[model samples]
Target: MSARVSDATSRLKSRRDDRRRHRIVGGLVAALIVVVLAAGVYVVAFSPVLSTRQIQVSGLKVLAKNDVVATSGIVLGTPLARVDITAAADRLAAVPAVADVTVVRSWPNAVSIAIVERRARLAIATDNGYLLADATGVVFQTVSDRPGGLVLVDAPTNDQQLLVDVGTVYSALSPDTAARVDRVVASTRDAIELRLKDGDRVIWGSAEQSGLKSQVLDNLLAKSGTVFDVSAPGFPTYR
Candidate 1:
């Protein structure tokens, strides 16, 4: 009876030891897995393997690629995950010629930049030369000579609203009529006018009803007149 009790106690102790061993082994494995995951995360987030190796610029025409890149403020060797895309894009958008910009991470080891440059629609005469203005009335650049395929704007002041009004009127004209326009003059927002290349003048009242005014002007040009007034398209006058 004593031997049997000892044997039973030994068996119970062995089972308890096995359970403890299993629990220890499981805890060690869990710790090892956690360490490996942390190491992997560190490698992906901070290691040089995922660092920015190249900057690819696209949709650039007027602005130099190098200049855009310089202004972007994106540094090589920066971790792709750490780059502030919005900040970079904002910096790029501040470029005078850039109308819109999109910055993104080309995964693995590269950054991609897409740019939409402003198109020069009009040239405002300035002391230095002609200041190029886009559709948004932003005078982005100046040139010593007049650029081709752009209308001239003659304003007493560089008023932003005047420029925008001129741009609106010019844009409203038909392609054929737009080509005939030599210069635009606007002393005030409501006193906008256009001078044709053939020495004809258009008395455009304001930016309002510009599309209707353009259509009326197109019809009136067929008549013999030096002065065409389409301030009110419903009551056009020519002489």
Candidate 2:
């Protein structure tokens, strides 16, 4: 009787395993059918029967619209589904001066690309060519064109902040005082000196108290004649 019970348990286990195998096979068949249907739909939707259409590009600065489209190797009437966005972005990024590139789908048969360009800060004159320096003072380009309106930076070689300090001092000056100013020079400790159009020197000590200084200069410039110096605020003395 005991042996008969053991045999019965083994048969039940075998039946359950068979049921699981059958279910798994049915699931695989269903997945295969779905995949086949999806592939068929894709072939119908984007097949050669569909005409390749226009490539749309936007947000481009450094790259010309045509160049971006051409780099994608995608021609008009080329199936949109065939264009690889990742590959297109990589190609556009290869173009010099293009800082960044983005590719996106525009549906049915259109593609869109976006490009960013490097920024130009100030261009200064050099012996042979004008050097273009970005905000961080790193020169990245040299060109033959005469770059204008950028003040030539002349400061002690040890001083690191002349360019930025002078620009700040100019910003703080009142219109009247600024108009009277001819050139601005940065000092060793970073206070800027503004050379007046009339050959007087205005010592703008540190950039800390500029609003006060502008008010004082506005009051003083009205009574100008052989002004000695206006360095420290309250004790401004002139001949």
Candidate 3:
């Protein structure tokens, strides 16, 4: 009986020791996993390997690269994961010449900037200088001297609809016809006129039927007339 009791006690002690060993091993593995994760996080978030080292620009025409870089305010050596892409793009969009901009982090050491620049479509004379407008009638740049190849506009800059109408008419002109145009004048949305490089005038009437008006003017230009009226294109008259 004494031998049986001692054997039973020994078995119980062995089972307890086994459980303690398992607990210790499990804790050590958990600690090791935590350390590994912390090291990986540090490497990715603070390491120089993924930091910005170069800048790549695309879709640039009028804006200089240096000017764009300065406007972006994205610093070199910043960790890729830490860059505020939205803020950088907002700053770039503030530039008058930029119509649309996209900023992104090209992983493993580069920042990419893609921008769409506004094309000069019309020139509006301002008190300070000339305001360059795009095809959508949004003024983008102010220049001291008049830019060539753009028709000067004499209209109320504050009248958005009038400016839009004028732009519509100007955009409808063919390259050959556009060259013959000197300036556009509008008192209201319904009263838009085109003055040719010569002393002739064209009553454009409104922004409606611009394509038909342009076609009629092409045919009328050959006739002997000082004034062309394509306002009613179906029954056009020139005198």
Candidate 4:
């Protein structure tokens, strides 16, 4: 009887130990599953591996949306954090129409891009092609928008430097004269010259003669077709 009792007790102890081992193993597996699930949830919810779904762009009339999108380098697979703002702006500016650009991050995984475009200021006739000048006087490129009989000017050595001064002279003309006039040639330093619709020419004389020049131009239209030199304020010359 003692031997049978001892055997029964031993068997009970072994069964208890087996149950305990199973419980430990089950707990460990459960912990591993929880950890894996948490990691997966975190990756799905907040990871930058996900593509940026929202893109907001402003100041984009002359520029095309697809062109801007392509230049941004922020495609469907591009992560929000991986985007290089400077590189994107540089790339966009390379498109020629873009003057300046600003890139900012939106909430979640969105990016916003703002662009400033260069407007066609003046048209010039080059030897091989046409020259396009912007409002700032910097020459862009030869474009097809050359209005008929529009006067083309000679590009100076420093095109950018000439743009501000010449643009000022171009803007200072009267509304009617400005509309009728086509090209202002930077023929010399002391003065700027304008080519009009007819055979008439207005000698600008000097940039200082802007207001006077505008008045002379307005008066010239009233008179017959002739060369009006507005270099002098009070005493204007006409041919």
Can you tell me which runs of candidate 4 are displaced by over 4 Å? 1-46, 49-51, 54-96, 99-102, 144-151, 156-160, 209-212, 219-225
Leading candidate by lDDT: 1
Scored against the true structure, residue 220 in model 1 reaches a CA lDDT of 96
**lDDT of candidates 1 onward, in order:** 0.90, 0.64, 0.89, 0.72
* Per-residue lDDT of candidate 3, residues 1-239 (tens digit): 99999999999999999999999999999999999999887776788878889889999888899889888888888888888889999999998789999998898889899999999989998787798988767787889988888889999878878888888998888778888999999999889999999979999999999998998889998999999998999988889
The RMSD (Cα, Å) of candidate 1 is 3.2
- Rank by TM-score (best first): 1, 3, 4, 2
The weakest ten consecutive residues by lDDT in model 4 span 149-158
Estimate the Cα RMSD of every predicted model relative to the unseen true structure: 3.2, 8.5, 4.3, 10.2
The sequence of per-residue lDDT tens digits that candidate 4 reaches over residues 1-239 is 99999999999999999999999999999999999998866654557654478778899776788879888887754566666778887788787677788887675677889988877667766656666666545565665557554446664645555655676677687767877676687755566788777757888766776776787768766876578887786777777
Top TM-score prediction, candidate number: 1
Q: In model 3, where do residues sit more than 4 Å from their true spots?
A: 1-41, 58-67
Preferred candidate (lDDT higher): 2 or 4 = 4
lDDT per residue, candidate 2, 5-87, as tens digits?
Answer: 99999999999999999999999999999999998767746676543576777776545777677887777776666777898
User: Candidate 2: RMSD over Cα atoms?
Assistant: 8.5
Q: Candidate 2 — worst ten consecutive residues by lDDT sum?
A: 151-160
Model 2 bad stretches (over 4 Å) = 1-152, 157-159, 226-228
lDDT of 4 at 219: 78
For model 1, the local distance difference test gives 0.90
C-alpha TM-scores of all predictions: 0.83, 0.43, 0.72, 0.59
